[model samples]
Target chain A: MTEQGTTSTALRESITAGLRQAVKRRFGAAADIDAVEFTSLGGSNRTVLFDLVDGTARRRLVFRQETIIPANSPFLDPARQFRVLSLLYPEGLPLPEPIFEFDDEDSLARAYVVAFVEGETVPRRLLDAPRYERARQRFCAQAGEFLGRLHALDPAPAAFLAEVPDSIDPLATTMARIDRWGGVHPALELAARWLERHRPTSTRRCLLHGDFRTGNMLLDEEGMRAVLDWECAHLGAPAEDLGWLCLRSFRFGHVDRPVGGFGPREPFYAAYASASGHPVDPEEVRWWEIFGFIRWAHYNVMQAYGHQTGARRSAAFAACGRNIALIEYELLMTLAGHYH
Target chain B: MTQDAPSIDELLVTVREFVQEITPQLDGRDRYHAQCAVYLLDIVRRELGADGTDATAEQAMLARYLGDGAAGAAGLAALAAEIRSGRLDARSDELLADLTRQVVGKVRITRPDQLHPMHRESRPAE
Candidate 1:
């Protein structure tokens, strides 16, 4: 066999053996794994889907493992993410059920298993697919309701999340990342100054799905199935999540539908207000939306830096460097009140 | 110095077409990377086609605010520092307009289609 082919085969064998060990330990010795498929979904994590068969019963599960973590990455480590999932799974949130976390005995380090939720997570498909038309109609209300419930969850149990820089001060955290990445972006600096000056006064801190947006959600024709990607979960202002969902970049060409390219802001805010019994503050949300743009730009810059420095070479990352221009344009337009 | 028959722009177009032609055969991650490649090629083409006028104008605009010797990457860093320090707060309106023009120039190269209709129309004709 060719050297590359031989190496891949050996790698696959090791993964299968590691998973077999995990399955046997969790589901008894009789249980075995079948059809392990690697999913290229997350940028900074490796996700594998597989079927664990115990006698006649078969269960589909996801094996999510941490990949190369960039220095000063904003995302939580796998252990912390799993902890967050375990803490929130019983809170009636629409999230995947956490199974078992990988231990030292398992060959796979920094990984965990969860019950696989079936739904589409791609933003393009969720936004444009004809099959998702009904889902799109119901998405805003569902998102608002979900966010309301998520934000209202008791923050005491997730106290560990407070260590996240975003939980302390999201704007400052993003600016720090930008600076570390050698981002000399004047547009982002301008946005940061604006954010600092017009900072929201509300001190209501709650558990936030720090990367709350359309792409991170799993949806079907009925509506949202589960909220995935908990790596960014933190304790922060509820409006932060609300604004993140309304980011212009997340609108995906459906600029008219301000809320995740699904519907207008009023219905979403109304749903949240109805659910949480807290009146939606448009001004605060607007501040967060501007902050969201800066945060998004920082992420892009970080990815581009990774590509440039050879930490993780990817065409997608290279594209991110160029995409910053579009993001900057939109951010400036939003700041100038030229875009709604 | 004379260049080859296939200019940089021509080569970019040919490679982009090749990527598109092979894109159908690829799936999943490869296809996504191919799409990104096409996007990067387009950006490069637009950047190459652009005259140096926008960049020169941007430098001049920055010099107006930061005085002479403020140009290029150093000028941008200085502008950002000034903005961060609130030294440019009084001139925010003018600064925002100039920054918008600069970002608009960038967007024109990277993804002009994303620009608002007003901004698109305001872009100087090539």
Candidate 2:
């Protein structure tokens, strides 16, 4: 076998053995694992799905391990992500049930397991499939309701989220990341000036699913099943999540339907207002939507830099280097009121 | 010296076609990477096919803002610095127009499909 193949084999074996120990510790010695499969859905983590059989009961669970975290990554650490799940899962939110977190004894570093939620998370499939037409109709309200419920949750427990740079000052945080990534983006600099000058008034800071958007959500034909990918969760303006959900990038070619390419924004805004008792401000969301483009561009730059600097090597990331121009064009258009 | 018959653009098109044909046979990460390869190849093809007019126009536009001494990447960096330092805030309207043109030039190569209708209509006839 090649050197990389050999390394992967060793890693797989280690994960299997570690999982067996973890399962036995949680579900007794009779518990056994079967059908371990790695999933490529996660961008910065290793996701492995396995079925645990204890007597007649078989439960499919996901084991996610943090693989490559850049030094300036905005994602929450594995431990903090698990903590967020633990705190919010009991709130009756549509989230994966946290099974157990790995400790030193489990021999799995920075990994956690949660019960697998069944649904489709692919944006294109959800947006284009005829079977999802009804689901798309209901998606906006459901997303708004979820965000309202999520933002209503007490921020005291997730107080640790405040330490996130974005939670402090998102514009400064974005600018810092841009500077760190070599910062020659004149368009982004223009965006920074606009965002700085037109800062939104202080609103109630709440727990935000920082990466809330189309692909981050799992939905069936009925509606949303679970909100996934809480790595970007942080305490911030409630509208940040709403704006992120409406980002053109997340619309997946269905840009006409601003709400995750599902439907109009009014249903979402109305649902959010009804659920949270806070009136939806279109202007505030617009401000955030504009900021969203810049943030999205920053993320693309991050990926491209990672590829060029050999921190990670992937053709997809290499494409992001050029994709930045597309994003900048969109940003300029949005700023000029020529495009949403 | 003259180049071969199968030039860079031709080679890119051929490779992109091959990758697109083989994409269905691959699955998961390989399939995703193949799709990205197709996109990158298309970008290279468009870039290679472009004339030098846009580049020259962009440099002249930047020079208008940053003076003749500033040009190319250095000019862009200087413009960004000026924006960040708030020196260009008064000239934001003109800067925005120049930046829009600069970014549109790039999008013309990377992804013309993403351009606004107005911008698309504004593109010079082939």
Candidate 3:
């Protein structure tokens, strides 16, 4: 029983009316309350896909809630993450324009739900179906530009400033945070030890996707529409964000190259640096790549829990648990790759 | 070691089978028991398989990264093993795990053949 995505702790429908009421009150007549239906999907949070009309228009909105999973963020307050999304949406990040957020005692059993955005987020299918290669430059350039914009965001924003931790060594902090996840298994313990010794110095703190990578974003031929999954979003070293995108794991199988199935490391860095006006460091890139493994490993543990306890048991979590090894192996290679 | 040397997959199958068989028999709510079974199976399975590859890899990584630090830091000097041996009994699992982590870019890129993405995040938009 490999743990799959974040598993539901209180999956039972304890209070459906309360959630609908919360939505109706916050979004109000703007969302056309009479014509909406909610259906829950996914295991990480209670994901409800709601079909509703707004001003003689129909829209399908998605909402998410955090459930019980091993290795969940003890440090992160879900309300805090929701608040961050609320703040950043107005600033023009390509993220789903978050609408109607509430994290209290009776919101879908735990911290849950915001307005859903639409887009297909597939990387495996990307290699075969309607390839982005046709629109690679636009996709690449747009992603680079978008990331640059995010990087350039005034850390001065009260929304961002209030919640995000100001850590001196964010790289170590990231590893330490993830290392906490490794305790679930002895092998992950190995992963923890591996990350600690290899942690890198911080370049400049910027916003992190927390889970930024290939599978976490939405893109079309034109380019990235928006980044998704801010569960791990925080202000951190700028190199961390770029490095996360470049992490080979994000490439899925495209290890020969990096950057979410893009061309190569140099191009991805060049595109980002050009757009953001920040110098790229191979060393820092290397560091975040390790952090990516730590993050992935924790997520993997969460996935295992989702499969074992929660309902979404499938080949997905079982196979994903094995992925932890890939990251561990990659770490091995990264260490041995340039050992003196 | 035949009984003990079950492949990771085999162990997982056994755990799943065991949980599936016993969960229905539990006196309490079937779903609750079933959920408990799933998590328990996962824990057992992780303990079974995580060691062979992860532990050995950690050992090899630490040996490689130590890079002549302590004159006698070389691993299994008797075996003359280079970095990459991931055996818990073989070395410092704690330190080696961290060292390999640093070297491999942390994404833990392994042979694609070894990994299979169980659930890919298919972004909702093209």
Q: Kindly report which residue stretches of model 3 are placed more than 4 angstroms away from their true locations once superposed.
A: A1-16, A27-42, A54-57, A69-75, A103-115, A135-137, A158-203, A301-322, A338-340, B1-112, B115-126
Query: Model 2: C-alpha RMSD to truth?
Result: 2.1
Who wins the DockQ comparison?
A: 2
Give residue A107's error in model 2 in angstroms.
Answer: 1.5
Q: All candidates' TM-scores?
A: 0.96, 0.96, 0.64
Q: How big is the positional error of residue A230 in model 3, measured in Å on the Cα after superposition?
A: 0.8
Candidate 3's error at B1, in angstroms?
Answer: 14
Q: Model 3 Cα displacement at B76 (Å)?
A: 13
Give the DockQ ranking, best first. Answer: 2, 1, 3
Question: Which candidate has the highest lDDT of all?
Answer: 1
Residue clash pairs of candidate 2: none
- In model 2, what is the error at residue A304, expressed in angstroms? 0.5
Ranking by TM-score: 1, 2, 3
Q: Write the per-residue lDDT of candidate 2 for residues A150-260, one digit (tens) a residue.
A: 988889998988889999988889889988886478998998898888999957999998999999989999999999999989889999999999988788888789998
